[model samples]
Target chain A: MKKSIILFIALLGLASVAYANESQIWGEMRIQNILGYGQEESLKLGVLFTMLQSKYFAWVFLGVLLGVPLVFFLHYKIVGPKVFPHSHKKHYAFNLFHRTVHQIAAVSFLVLLPTGFIIVFGDFFGGGTLVRMAKNLHGLFTIPFAIVVIPMALMWLKEALFNLEDVKWFMILGGYLSKEKQIINATQFNAGQKMWYWVAILGGITMILSGAFMFFLDFKMEMLHNITGLSQIDLLRVAAILHNVMGFAVVALFITHVYMSMFAIKGAVYSIITGYVEEEEVKILHNAWYKKLKEKGKF
Target chain B: MSNEMSRMKFFCDDHRCIECFACSVACAEAHELPTGISRRKVITLFDGIEGKEVSTSIACMHCTDAPCEQVCPVDCFYIREDGIVLHDKEKCIGCGYCLYACPFGAPQFPRDGAFGAKGAMDKCTMCAGGPLETNSEKERHLYGQNRIAEGKVPMCAAVCSTNALLVGDAESVSTIYRKRVAGRGKGA
Candidate 1:
């Protein structure tokens, strides 16, 4: 913390020297008259400034700090410490291929998010060395991330689709904050899980597209300009904006998804790791899918 | 805003420019810039045309609210009192956000290390250099000439044989531009 303060002071001093060379009076008039701080310019500055200085994100963190506890207190008040009783019996929930795909996706997301943040918010992470390293690693991980996204989307597409049963699951809050055991007739995934899947799939696709547009196509900007009616500048601007928006959404979803899997749900993380769940646990949670398996003589 | 210093702007007279490339050469020579980086360039709108080709020496326009400054995630860029948008190379991540953000394609990058990775962004500082001390060796190495600090016109504008490139206060430059256009009776 002391080091950070010292670094901050040094950087500010350096900046002041750069700025002080010019007349103080001219700067103000130039901003008001020549620069014309238009709405687009204002938004760009606002977004980039927030990323650099973290002033806006400080408020976001404060909201998260206050909101998370409020949510926890509400959940505690409503649901208390209710845990389902289950016997020690195992049943197949995920196949080997599904587990493999999930593992790849999980690892990629974990690596990509932090690296991406470091590159985008380079000011907070220190000088060019760390930022360059983060940028390189972020580029490298994007390849695996892009490859995994396609397979993961295909692997979970059918299970993630919304159905009439999902409506009932939503009505009961997916049995999340209920003291009574509301029998949610969900298949392999509940409404909440399905939502997570879709967000990851769609958001991941957007990130891949925008990232690809930024990385490879930049060199061929002239060709792109001829092919597309829009100028290369406009395309790049749109890509940057899209990349930022999708990045924020994906990160938010990933945090909540990880928290729910590891802490909120019992045996959930275990099931993902082992590719199996207790038969009694499946009977209570995924009763619809369990009944189908039983009728098929597979359970 | 004040009598001491005025908001500066750069203008290139299209009619007077002859696509000589002298301004570009003068800028590179004066700055002693790296081989790959050209801060100023003579851009021809049409090539191999009889009396239809229009060319102008272009560089950073030193925009009032520069998009490069606005979009830089590391906040490396800063506009001076004279509206000369300068950037700190120390703070720059070389992510090319400025390149993408700039409408004029002003930002230049040099390949560094093995496999030609992008090192840092180099652009027309408008002869103002960077955040370093005025006319310092470090400033010269990173940001080229500091002629603006020394109260001299930019090398590109200075060496233009036809007096095409003009660099001064925006008000004075516009007044000159208006007279030149009115004399010709056609806007360039």
Candidate 2:
């Protein structure tokens, strides 16, 4: 952490010549005016938006959407699946409410990600009826995801918070780098899972907000003028930029979450599906939680 | 020959504009646009602020390097040889990326989406119709008028009370603007 802080400070001071080679102050200023911030301009944010939209967003999104799966394929080939023997003994992990919320979030994500990509690389499909259908489907799925996102955050907030043991879990990369059955320091949810929780819930909310702005073009940004200080047009620009940036993170993290849940640990999905975990699987993968349960005589 | 093959353009002189909405109204009436759609709009900045007030009419402008063409997901926008930027309404998904990209806010989406979001895009076609055969009934209904093919000036410029809006060959348009500025003693 000390080294990271020092490096961060060093990088900050390394270049005093702070100027955007990719100038887009006008766009950012417009956004500031719309969101009711009343600022002169968001120079850096505009530069970033201009750079992303003009050149990088397509390539970066393409890389993440396609590259992540290729990476999982290699990982699977090397480490193979960690299959724990099924014992009739089980522990209830998710209740009906939890399972229902998870399903809603999952199904919405499944629809949104593909349709979002189709909209991103819209011209690839020749900008016709097919892409339009994807655009519509993308908007429709936002409703379900929006409903469950807050609940998902509230339910998982405690487990998703970082603990000292999570640092150790990170060092070993959650024991997935090797094909060995290791008693990991993770509780029910590991550091990686915690990261996914924040990105999905929090990032999902921001996407909903920004998507709403773009979705309902007629929705007035006037009342928000004093608070956000952005013109309506510029606010839309910021929303579009933010939505794309969030897409990059969500796509990468969501793919990892899916792969870990379904493929990395065989039969791991049973917990989510039936709200029961195999006794042996819990004892090995989540020893910390397993020990607590055992102490309480729940095991 | 130059007017036919050269770049077409629009220039809205703010000093001459009266904020009467005549250009916008002429555009809609001539094209028989829907209740809310305005192909040309007059914006008054600092309205009623005495000397600070300034108004200008704006439309597609048909930019040579249009940003909407760049960000469009469906590649709907195309530039004609005469430099009129047009889009095929059939291919438009109404996703509104063009609305975000446009500096002028030219692209307008009807609230006709699958949800209450949007439908296919509607925007200034520079009086030039879409990919359909020029002046067809379907083209007229989907994209308004095909006045460019009819060998007439776009109605917005034609009916401008103050001649604040002008559209034609680039050279002619600039010459007119230069003349206006010189007469106003604002040009060197």
Candidate 3:
């Protein structure tokens, strides 16, 4: 009888702890552990949140915001653009559907980057209607990006995959390091483009999902606990960390992609809009793709 | 009057708190708060005792180094000389960063935008109002009454029957805490 009574009392003891008791001690209530700091995960998350709010994220962003543009400026000044004719025989590269999706994603990203930077360096603008508007637009623009992200991924997935030819492309920097146009062997998408494609699609999806957690604040912790064994606040910490880390990657790659299209290779930006690749430029820059077309007797 | 210049703070005496929603009700009524907003809440801290209950009132403790101020992207928060943390509603984009950083869960948001998007952040202003002109019509409209400007205690503390919710200078509050601890023949 004593053993059975002890067993029943032990179950009762376990029940109290399982009932979401804020205090870890069986009877003592700790004021410090109230609210968000109630669990060990909550405590660790608090520390992370503090580090995030401090100059840590800002200093890292400063490197990207200041450091990247300087490299681009140097590249522009020294190497010069690979100039190509705008009007030429259209070597059909992208279709109307592909062009439309690319344009929408590009425009959305164009808005997202600046606004997101504004949010990252928010203290500079000193909060008001402008930052608030930026915040709202950031969420609003996510819709278009989210809609096109999947299609964009599937369309470019096969071409964006890396192969041995890409190794050679990476070695010579895709023949973009010099002024003189050199014939380069690159597949439909070069090594640089393949890297960009993965970053934009995968990193963008992670950023979107993480941003959603912050946007919708009313989602219950219990539901999240059932899924991730974490409280809502802990999940939020993870989201914020993921979002910021992905933001860094997206920002870096987006800048590179923009530079490669608009400045590094002249008239390349127009191809996305016009849905045509310059045949002469493709022959020089995409030698492998040009060879494939020649073998097929298309050119 | 001189005490107003000291760093302002709140100390809820956990021992005496009765969980009577007086402070919360008084704050809501005094501020004419929106339906979903409450600046002060009494929460039960311990329920292990068979019949006795220990509870405490919680709100924005208005920390010396306020985390909300640190995390706000818009630089909306500004601490006064007396250490009461305040923010500009006009500048707040309602991004909810401050909400995440605040351990107390002090920042409150009214669902104003479409699909329940957060409006400007609202929290315990410590009866000091916001960045607008003191006690002006616009200030009152945006941030409720400015009791501090009128030389009065915050409404919640003023109405606290058990004196559990203490609000004053840090030194004064700590002195009282020390006295209460000594009176109980123990230390917190």
Q: Which candidate leads the pack in TM-score?
A: 2
* Candidate with the larger DockQ of 1 and 3: 3
What would the per-residue lDDT of candidate 2 be over residues B90-136, giving only the tens digit for each residue?
88889777766665657776666665557888888878888998899
- Give per-residue CA lDDT, model 3, range A1-299, as digits (tens): 34543654454355434534432211122244344463554556755776686657777787888888789889999998888876666677889999999999989998998899888777798777778778888988997897788879888899998999888888998888888899988878889999999999999889877887777654543445588866555666678878888888888888889888888888798888877888888888888888898787764
TM-scores for chain B, listed for all candidates = 0.94, 0.93, 0.93
Error of 2 at B79 (Å): 0.8
Q: Give per-residue lDDT, candidate 2, residue A190.
A: 85
Ranking of models by DockQ:
3, 2, 1
Candidate 3: list runs displaced more than 4 Å: A1-43, A85-88, A221-223, B1-5, B45-53
| Candidate 2 lDDT by residue in tens digits, A1-299 | 34543653443343212212211222223223323322354433333444467678889999998899999999999989889876668888899999999999999999999998888888888877888899889988987887777778888888889999999988999888988898885788888989999899789978987887676554443356467765555666788898998999999999999899899988898889999998888887788988988888875
Model 1 segments more than 4 A misplaced? A1-82, A85-87, A221-228, B1-5, B32-36, B46-52, B111-117
The regions of model 2 sitting more than 4 angstroms off are A1-51, A221-223, B1-5
Worst 10 residues of 1 chain A by lDDT: A24-33
**lDDT scores in order:** 0.70, 0.78, 0.80
Give candidate 2's error at residue B120 in angstroms.
Answer: 1.3
* Clash pairs (backbone) in predicted model 1: none
